[model samples]
Target: MSTATATPEGALPHRDLSHTPWRVLVLGATSGIAEATARIWAREGANIFLVARNADRINAVAADLRVRGAAYVETAVADLDDIDGHTALLGRAITALGGLDVAYLAVGILGEQPRAEQDTTHALHILHTNLTAPVSLLTWLSNYCVNQGFGTLAVLSSVAGERGRKSNYVYGASKAGLTAFLGGLRNRVDREGVHVLTIKPGPVRTSMTTGMKGSEKFADPDKVAREIARAIDKKQDVLYTPFQWRPIMAVIRAIPERIFKKLNL
Candidate 1:
């Protein structure tokens, strides 16, 4: 049985979350980019529900958001990879928030490329967390939003997904799949008044890219978060953070396979 709230059909487009006191749900609330984005919403006095696997980290995040001026902050500790629990978890979140306005999905992993190449288990783990789990959550969320006729689904994909490079093809593939999924989901739900945003960010100064080469050149998370906040208000369909990544990925995609495979990415 579905637990989603129902509303009158043919409602108008959702009001932008830029309005103060938005009811928001942040999955993977402990991630650097996610936490930074939540902080922006917090300053607007948004009501938030945080979900993540780490109890200590999630609790700290909730506390910080409250201090940052969020009107309300609630949290639940749960591993999002457990697809079986998504429905119940989302139900609780919606209840806590009084209703749903925006859901930011910032859950993903960058598995060791060499290890993934040798171990199917490692590769599958990456795919499961980055792809399958998100699909499950989106399926439930999209339906709920469709029934109510309003919501924004902002998801984190990666510029790496634009074209696969030998360096981290496994992670790239997962993001590529997610990007495609978001595209199709937008096509299906846009007419129903649900906005689906695919956020393709280049490497940012986050824990995920902490030890990587050229880490000093990565984009700042705070700046990226600001763009994201604006994009949601504008209801953009796709966002390339740092903006330069849009052209950079275009060039990479335009390269022919014969010449591309020879050059290191």
Candidate 2:
């Protein structure tokens, strides 16, 4: 058990468990980035609550974490798109863990841009999954952490959100909304002693982008995970996972709309 402190939200008091080990809840536990992060945190002796919709994959990952020296490993199943399921899933994980010290919101879908534009259903699903779901989950989680008085909430935004490109603007748009939401969320919670880290990763070679080409600049999931862990320790406000992407995206974001539209990015 850790020492508890009162927070502004008055939900659940937080504790300084840093001297002990950490307990982390990872949404999208099956994601390459999330899985890698879990491994890194577990290696440092954190208890892990891995949440994902796939039971087989989650269990396998949990087992791996235990073998790798995690203090404890637990699993929860939920599809991010299912509102009720996501709520129940998170509630159960938090209860099982006793408390949450860190949360990584790492679920997203990258639908085909053309398909999303052509189909309302596709666009809606993408928007809901990427933007709305995360916003809702973070709102709940942040409140919980704020009341607890100390915790870090890391949200995975993207460079695409900085400026939409013709190549994948629909997906980019969804991320854009998420980025904005997280910005406001950070502002609202920081005063309460809760840290929010907005991570904008440019490219990653994950199963999600398996067929994508020209990804030489992509960061590895393991590297990204390590960076995230370091950022959390430092209480960073926002981070470009690779560090290099900050300036790269800055230039991209500064491009004039007319000229940017003419160029094939």
Candidate 3:
């Protein structure tokens, strides 16, 4: 039987896949959250399509998943900043998996605010990587999944998107655009048997925040992965990774703009 035709035991929402294996395509496979999520899904018996820019890192992650009992694992290298490559990358991932059941767009960059302020190029790069690329990829994936008549498109947004703050407004703005985009995508695909989940994580301890100082209420990558898996299984529309961020962001959103501007968050 073809690799895609071989069904992995214990795949979620179990279905007869005589032509394809139950597969997940993770865009930022080397990222902490994506890596954690990949491990969790591997444990659950799902084939993984690990996509990242770094070949070595992606291969290492794929190997790690194999060691962790992943039924099947594949890696693809693509720089998300290459706008022309988005659709092709998604298509390649789908083909690699023989099909796709879940597509996680977890690729993002958290650039330094001070650097962004000084360099327009850097700012635009961050915006494109964080917002534009995901939007374009999801648009393609959404149409593809809808045409296939099933699948889930999961996006990792941020609590920072809830409201713009002085510290990371550019980053937050990009996430804000993503959050809004996913909201519309969710509404559009709900009746089509396609699931769209927008994950808003307040603070996560990942390489993205490496060297950042001080203790804060941060969610571990593993914890965030667990929440993501649960949200996918439950077909949840929106999720706050740690759950507490929902109320916290609500309050942050409610803060008077004048007052909010006065104090650094």
Top of the candidates by TM-score: 1
The CA lDDT of each predicted structure is: 0.91, 0.83, 0.83
Stretches off by above 4 angstroms in model 3 are 1-21, 215-217
- Across 147-181, the per-residue lDDT of candidate 2 in tens digits comes to 77778999888888988777888899999999899
| lDDT tens digits by residue: candidate 3, 45-159 | 7889988999999999999999988889988888877777765667777777777788998999999888998999988988999998887788888877776667889899999
Weakest 10 consecutive residues of candidate 2 by summed lDDT:
1-10
Q: Candidate 1 vs candidate 3: which has greater TM-score? A: 1
Candidate 2 wrong stretches, greater than 4 Å: 1-17
lDDT of 1: 0.91
Superior by lDDT: candidate 1 or candidate 3: 1
- Each candidate structure's count of clashing pairs: 0, 3, 0
Provide the lDDT at 122 for model 3: 88
TM-score for all predictions?
0.94, 0.92, 0.91
User: Residue 223 lDDT in model 3?
Assistant: 88
Full-model lDDT, candidate 3: 0.83
Candidate closest to the true structure, highest lDDT:
1
Residue-wise C-alpha lDDT for candidate 1, range 1-265, written one tens digit per residue: 3433433234434565455579899999999999999999999999999999999999999999999999999999999988878888898898888788999999999999999999999999999999999988898899889887889999999998888889999999999999999999999999989999999999999999999899999999999999998999899999999999999889899999999999888
After superposition, the stretches of candidate 1 with alpha carbons farther than 4 Å from their true spots are 1-20
